[model samples]
Structure formats: C-alpha cells, structure tokens
Target: MTDFVEVDTAAGRVRGRWRPTTGTGRMPRSAAFLGIPFAEAPVGPLRFQAPVPKAPWEGVRDALEFAATAQRGDPGVTLIPEPSVPGESTLNVNVFTPDPDAAGLPVLVWIHGGGYFAGSPASAWYDGRNFNRDGVVTVSISYRLGFDGFGWIEDAPSNRGIRDWLLALEWVQQNIAAFGGDPSRVTIAGQSAGGGAVLTLLGMEKAQHLFHGVYAISGALADVSAERAEKFGRGLAAAGGVAPTVAGFSSLDEERVIALQKKATELGPSSLGSIVEEGLPLGPSVDGDLLVRPTRESLRAGVGADKPLVMGATDDEFTMAFSGVAKKLRWVPKAFLLNRLGMPKGAMRPYLAANQDALERGTAGIAGRLLTDRMFRTAVLNIAEDRGDAPTWLYRFSWPSGTFGFAEHCLDVPFFFDCLDGPAMVPLAGPNPPQALADQVHAAATSFIETGDPGWPVHEGDRGVVRVWDTPVSDVVDGYASVRALREPVS
Candidate 1:
C-alpha cells in the first residue's frame, strides 16, 4: 500500500506519497513530494521576470504530481524524452527523501536538460527514488525554458531560467531540512544543457554557497554576447510582431508567444548566423550582471575554486544530434566539408588513418567528431584545467546506446539516476542495459553528494586523471590528448 504523508514547507502544508523501496531489506522506502512550488508562477505580469518566492498557501496543497513544464515545442524531435504536464507553476521542485523525519542527510539537486529550450522534471527517467533508497534526498527542479526563460528582452531580466535555478536553490536552503536533507551538504548536478547550467552556476557569484559540489554530464557551454542577445531578441520580437519588451510578450496569448518563440528558434540557423555558425542559439548570455563574463573565464578567475566538481562528456556527444543530418550529407563534397569543419583538406589525414571507414562514410563521421570536441568535450576539459585548484574528477561516458553506435548525449542520465527501467528510457538505454555500469555511476554520484568525492584522484596540472565509464571501467591520465590536440582554441 502506498503511504501518504504531509510536511509543512515555507509556503504551506504539502501532501506527498511514499513508495516502498524495491531494494534489499536494508534499503529504505522513499517519500515523494512532487509539484512543490519553489517560486511564484511566471505568468502574465510576472512573465520574463526573475523568480519570486511563491506566496504561502492556506493548507494541505496536493504535491502528488509533476508540475507543467515551461513552454516548449513537441518533445518527439529530441533524443531525450520530455514529458509535459499542465499547470502554471512551472517553477517547482520534486523532493524524494528516505525519511521525512530524518535529518542531516545529504541533498542532490538535479536540473533537467533540453538544449535551453525544452525538457521537464516530469520525464520518467528523472525519478529520485533510487537516490532516496541510498539515503540521499534528491530534489529535481523545473524552470522557465525557451523564449520565456532564456530569450533576452530589453525590459526583462536576462537568464531568467538561471534566475529560476538560483531561486530553487534558495528554496532548498529554506525547506529541504523538513524533507530530511542537509542544506549544508548539497550537490547540484545536471546533464546536457542542465550540465551547462551547473557549469554556468559555478561561474556566477550569485550561486556561491548554494551547493558544495557539482556534476556536469555532457555539458555544453554556449554564452552569447549582449550584441548577439539583443539581435536575437529583436528578431524574435519581429517574428512575433510585438515590442521587444516583457510587457509586449506578456500582452500576447501564452500559446501565441510559445508559437512565435518556436518560429524564432527554427529561424535561428539562418537569422542568427554568428551563433548558428558556431552551432548555438538562444542560450545563456553574458548579461554583465549575474554572468559578468564568459563561463570559462569566470572559472579561471576562481569563481568556483572552492567547490569539488565531477565533470565530463560522452565519447560521441553529438552522435545522436548528427545521426539524421549525417546520412543526408553523404553526397556532399569533401572539400566543402573540410572548409565547413574549419579544417584544411589534408587535415582529415589523421582522422582517416584512425578510422579507415571514414572515407566511405564521407564527412559525416568527421563532422560529428569535430562538433563533439568543439561543442562539448573541449569546453569540459577547459573548465577542468581552469579549476585545477579544486577537487575535480573527470570522466568519459563511452558506453554506446544501441540506437547509436557511440555514447550519445543524454545516454548516461538514466544510469546516473539508476532509472534505466523507466518507461521513457527503454529506447535510449535499450533492453538489458548493463546494470553494473548503472551501479558504478549511481554509487559514485551518491558518494559525491555525501562526501564531496566521487572515488577518484583529483585532476591536477598536465597529468589529469580521468575515469572512463565503460565495460571494465578504468582510469587514464590525459586521455583527451588526441582530441585536445585537434581542438581549436576557444574564441
């Protein structure tokens, strides 16, 4: 039988449900307080503003279901599954705890990824039950997305989504103790754009002391300049036929705003040539306030020097992203491919020698590899190098998803959450994925949350050791040398 429980939060009394543990007798059951509002709904006049704390409710608000996601396009187009629910209070968090009465347990806060445009905490793969069973209190959060969250508006706060993240962390600080979590022992983590969020937060002074450590999985860093942000915002306003301000956006119907945002994003590749040429659009911007500089520079200046961190990307971070597009590029000329990839014709010599089949496959494979290195892998390594003073553990998720030959982006998420069996994970993980890998990833993550270490030597100086998560997991120093050598310096 499911057990129902209630906890008094800063906002009001919330009713939650308890799901019995499916583990051995030693494992503890977990309580789930879902759809707990951490901030006021960013709707109507509040839209595009920094998150405000939700007003206190009267009594016994049902916290039994996931909240609605921020406005987004259909999720079917993305590799990761994004389940949408319906509600206005998208600035909410889901808390899973071993025992609501227990105190001082470590807390793990998760931010879901959707390319800064889509995704929600309601995805089945994000269930925090396994975390609770392991004696950790897990909190998964939802924030604004797409134009509503990241779009730059003249009258609205920049990085509103990031602001939502900070507000949620503040909420955790204020209320997690009642859910059996120690606010002082918080570790924030995210995958893909969420992972980017982790790194972004690390670089922000506003995020100081919010969490003791962080995990960035397949993190992709994309920061737009104010000029670029304003240009994109103006274009979005033009597309929507509204003034380039929060008031104009607020006056439009919510669905109409979402539709226009979708159109703007779809036009990003052609309209926002500067960012699209670099394979990025409508993400975090250097707003000169919350994020005073680029994230890498901020880290180099010691923004996150005190926190322990675990950061890495998959071997083929963009394999899934390139799957369909690659197939269509088979007939494209090699010279054009070389030019587009910023590599001279003979530059393919080393890659060709490494993969004999690359020639037959044309530039698709090479392009995917280059994109992976430039967009994800190099960014992660750069962060590691800059934050060398901190206790940082690096990793490479090499286990391939059966659907894609390489370790695709978002593939490691289920393993990290130990939710491979979640309904939405089957296609990504395949049936009968290696449970052993899941155990190793989950154990290491739980260990990090509890003690700020992930069972590996700290990466230091030139000889940075990296944990390779694959069959027969092993550690190697400077494993990224080949790709790093080929990587162009960040612009």
Candidate 2:
C-alpha cells in the first residue's frame, strides 16, 4: 500500500507522497503534492484568456504524480531533465512541504526558464525536498508557453502566460497556508525566463501582494513591445494559415500551432543580432493594462520598491555555445563580428576592449561573451540600478563547469537548489561539482528566502560590490566593471 499524506486545501483535499531526503537536507523526509490545479486548463473557452480559478473538487485528489506541462517535448532549452506531461488540464502547481499541518513556515515559489517559449516545471532538478527539509515550503508552477501563451489575438488577451503566473501566485497566497506555508513569507525565484518572470512580477503593482522577496538567476527579460508582439502574432498566424483572432487559433490543433511557432520565430542570418535587436518573439509585453509599462520602467517608478531582490547571472552564460566557432573564426576581427551582431560602430572597440578576457578566446568566444553580456549581464546591472537601492543584493556565479570549462547557463541551478547530487547535475555541472560551493550558494538562497537577505553585501548605489560564487566564495568591488562599456555611450 502506498503511504500518502493528506492535506486539505481551500478547494479540496489532496493526497501526496513522502520521500526521504536525497542529499544532506536536515529533514529525514518531505511530502510532495504534485499537479494540484490552480486554474482551469486554458482549453476550449478558456483558451488565450486570463486564468480562471479551479472549481472546488468533491473528493481527495491524488497529487502523487506530476501534472501536464504546457511544454510538450524535450526542447533542449532548459538544459535540465524537464519532462513534458500531456493533458488538457495543464494549469497546475506542485507543492513540497515539510509539514502541511505546521504553522507559518517560509515559502519559495519557483518559475522555470525556456526563453518564454519552452520549459517545464516537472523537472527533477526542481524537486523541493531539500528546501522542505530546511523549513521552506517550495512550489514549482507551470504556465502556457510560446505562441499559444504570448501571441496576440484580437479577440483574446495578450500575455496569457503572464496572467498564468499571476494567478498561480494568487493561488499560493490563498492556499499555501493550508500546506504549512506562511502566506506573508513567500519569495518568488526562477532561472532564465523564469528569472525574468519574477522580475516582471516584482515590478507589477498588481503582484506586490503576492511575494515578499525575489531571487532571479540569469534572468532573460522579455519586455516585448505591443507593436512587435502584434507583428509576431500576425507572422505566426500567416505561418499557420489562421487568423490573428481567438476563433482562428481555437480552430487549429494545439500541436500544429506548436510546430508553426518554431518556424515563425526561427533566428535569421545573424542569430545573435536577431536576438539582441528583435528580442524574444513571444513573452510578457506592454499590454497597457496588466503589464502597464515595461518592466524596467515599472521598477524605475518604484512600483515594487518595498520587496527585497537578489539577482545575478553566471559569468559565462552561453559563451560556451559559441566555443565551437573559435577555430573557424580565429582570424575574424572581433570588431567585425560585433558589427554583424548589430553592436553600434561607436560601441564596438570599447565593448571589445572591456571584455578583454573574452577577447583572448578568439572570435567565437568574444561573440558568445557579447551575447551573454548584452542579453543577461547588462540587464542585471540595469535592473539593479533602476531599482535604486531597494534592498538588493548581487552576485556572479564564477565557477566554471567541471565538464564545460565555462560557468555556462543553468550551471548554478543545482547549486541554488542544493541538489548537486540530483540526476541532472552531471550533464551541466560536471561529474564532481564542488559540494562546498553548492553549500554556499544554497545557503545564501535559503537565508534570503527566510530572512529577506542572502547574507552578503547589499547592492548600494551601483557600488558594484557582488558576491563571486567560486572557490572560496568572496565579495569583490566593481566585480561587473568588465561590462561597463555596454552600460555607457562608447565613442
């Protein structure tokens, strides 16, 4: 017989399973209630609409298994073992708690990353047992992905995926207490696109009540404009032979739309240039209603000034992706490639000079570094500066992957989760990642979630003091000085 733990939620009773702690989590075992629906699946009438709360259920629902995810297949974007589950009802949340009956425990709400188009919450790397053991109830959530979630339809709403996130947080606020989580002590965190989601949420006035703090890891901000979003939507519809309306999209098969989205959003001749110039084809946009203005603008206006934030990116996120071109483009002038990547002529020399270490790696390495710096590192600095001393902490994951030789994207996730022993760690973090670094990173994360500070120096007035997460983790001054060229007008 399966031994199940039952917890009564606002809508219904759920039966979850208990597993012994995998690594060195303090608790012996923690309960995981997977696939608890927070909203009706965005199908039929709900397609492309704001999430509607799940209706109350009659009997105890078994949450022993993971739920369906909007991401339908292995897209290789997340770099983790993110599985795609199939079903019409895909709007759900998975809860991992130390004790559903306990009172007033802190909560960590996680969002996953996949460039706003692909990613799944159902990844082993995200299981929250370690957090649960440490007294932080953890929740990983799912949202609509790609064109279906972000594509503009005249009759339907925009930013459906964004809406899904809002509704999921609302669910946490209302029901997390039933799972032994304190409603007031919730902190939202995520990597990549998910990191961007938390930042977006942090800047939302409507979302200020949902979570108390944020920790964004290598966030890839979308901030797509309304005009661009509409254009992408029209292009997607043209590719699918459908109208840019609810009726046309609803008539098409979900699988067909999925296929069309990729073709429609494929990168052009200059992949890096396209990403930097056009930005993601689908993601949270300035809808003038829910989103109001852009995320940075919202932050600048002090929309969510009260909440604490901790954010950073790996030193070489995705730089390794361009390593293969190192030899082929060895002789290529770094300035020429930066020009091709759409960096202004005025900015090329200065940008290249600022990133000298990357410059030494030849063309491919330099290009990759520019891509990471432009897309992620610069964004971090911008957000931190825009935030204007609102209780912020910054850090850089500087430890190169044991296998990849670069810090790389997704490398710090297992460390953040304190799950270096997790099944997916080796592929990204290599065979023997330093357990001590994981201890430091995870400890900081747990500390921040619990006390609203990551136990490091706070980012004040662009001092550039940042925690360098490598061997003998230590604080440094102006740690991000290398990327300063992109921050200012270089002529």
The model with the greatest lDDT is 2
| Superposed Cα deviation of residue 43, candidate 1 (Å) | 1.2
| Model 2 TM-score relative to the real fold | 0.97
Cα lDDT tens digits for candidate 2, 179-224: 9999999999999999999999998888888999999999988889
- Candidate 1 at residue 148, lDDT? 82
- What candidate 1 gets wrong by more than 4 Å, as runs, is 24-26, 72-74, 267-279, 325-328, 333-335, 344-347, 351-362, 488-491
Candidate 2: what lDDT? 0.88
TM-score for each prediction? 0.93, 0.97
List pairs with backbone clashes in candidate 1. none
